[model samples]
Target: MSAVIEVVSVINAATGTVFDLERDVDVHAESLAGSRETATTTTGRRQLTLGDEVTFRARHFGLRWRMTSRISAYNRPHHFVDEQTRGPFRALRHEHHFEDLGDGRTRMTDRMTIRAPFGPVGAVTTRIVLAPYLKRLLTKRAVHIKRLAEQVG
Candidate 1:
């Protein structure tokens, strides 16, 4: 079975503005508050588009890893999805969603599905990782984003 982790947080920023922030790859990296280190192509464009290939180097739980992903889906100021082309997981799919809370706040959710490379051993890996740990990581990331967005204006 594949392991899935979903985390949601409320960002005290306009829904539209928050949505725009997620669309820019650089912004997303920055909102993580230096948690991720990235490099771009010769074009030097930070905004992401459907089918764009991007590479990211980030540390999670003190473990540094690199991921090369392609933007599998993009739908303007609403939601976007990315899938890993080359990385640790046998399969990795991430979906970013934004919802309005009717008070200038945005509810942002991250849904991640990962299939570890070691087959049944991956199931054991998931158990070891625990959903709560993954949730905490996402929560920390959201907090950083919330602070950044709220402070921007």
Candidate 2:
């Protein structure tokens, strides 16, 4: 298992506003410029729905990566979790959370876990082959999300 990555940003926006917008897949896709796409998942789409699948495709370091993730857990106006069905790593889980500091600002956090193959060998391989790619992806994603959220605020 690889080390999990967590990134956070404080947005000058209401918690409720940010929470509601984040739950709407279409709105999220538009906000993030079509990085995520929603469809009729086998389990269906509902608030806090589990097993509902969604696909996200984006460019990272000029390489296109796609993830078909399932909605595993959620609590409206607070947190949601998604696990990847397809991607580079052997497995991936991502959780999005929000906090209200009572000052009209929302703190958004993203936590991601990835399990790579080959165990120790994979770790070494990743450091050499995938680490840079993943870093660039995370950096680009953070900047994009920050810009999008701030733009809406």
Candidate 3:
């Protein structure tokens, strides 16, 4: 079974600024500092664009994981999609959407779809453990991004 997780965050910054921060590799690393995540390939510290691929190394659940993701879709400050080429999960897709609130704020939403590796057992584990863990991780990342974007604006 595949698990889909959605996380929404409101940022007190412009949509463009929020979108830029979302694709900034350096900001991602900083936001996920607790996971010790790093961009191991591509334009290491640059913003990701369509057709750009990045490999990330991170420690999760007491294990080191590596995932290569490609920018499958891009549409300025509106939305973008990243799909995993290779990763710990059997499959992974993350879609980021940004909505301008028309008052210097943006509503950012992350919709992630993930499939585990071990078939039925993995599906059960994903539902019991992975889902909550990922939700928390996503929440933390969003909060960090919001703080950074707000600070810069």
lDDT of candidate 3 over 1-153, digit per residue (tens): 899999999899999999999998888889899999998547654899998999988999899999999999999999999999998889999999999998899999999999999999999999999988998988998999899889986
Task: Give the range of the ten consecutive residues with the poorest summed lDDT in model 2.
Answer: 34-43
The list of candidate 2 runs beyond 4 A from truth reads 23-49, 59-64, 127-132
Scored by lDDT, model 2 comes in at 0.67
Using lDDT as the measure, the top candidate is: 3
Instruction: Give the TM-scores of the predictions, in the order they appear.
Output: 0.83, 0.71, 0.96
User: Considering TM-score, which of the candidate structures 1 and 2 is the better prediction for this target?
Assistant: 1
lDDT of each: 0.75, 0.67, 0.92
- Root-mean-square deviation (CA) per prediction: 2.5, 3.8, 1.1
Best by TM-score: 3
lDDT of 3: 0.92
Instruction: Residues 13-64, candidate 2: write the lDDT tens digits.
Output: 7776666656556554554453443333444443335567876666544667
| Candidates arranged by TM-score, highest first | 3, 1, 2
Error of 2 at 58 (Å): 3.8
Regarding lDDT, does 2 or 3 come out ahead? 3
Q: After aligning candidate 3 to the native by TM-score, how far in Å is the CA of 29 from where it should be?
A: 0.6
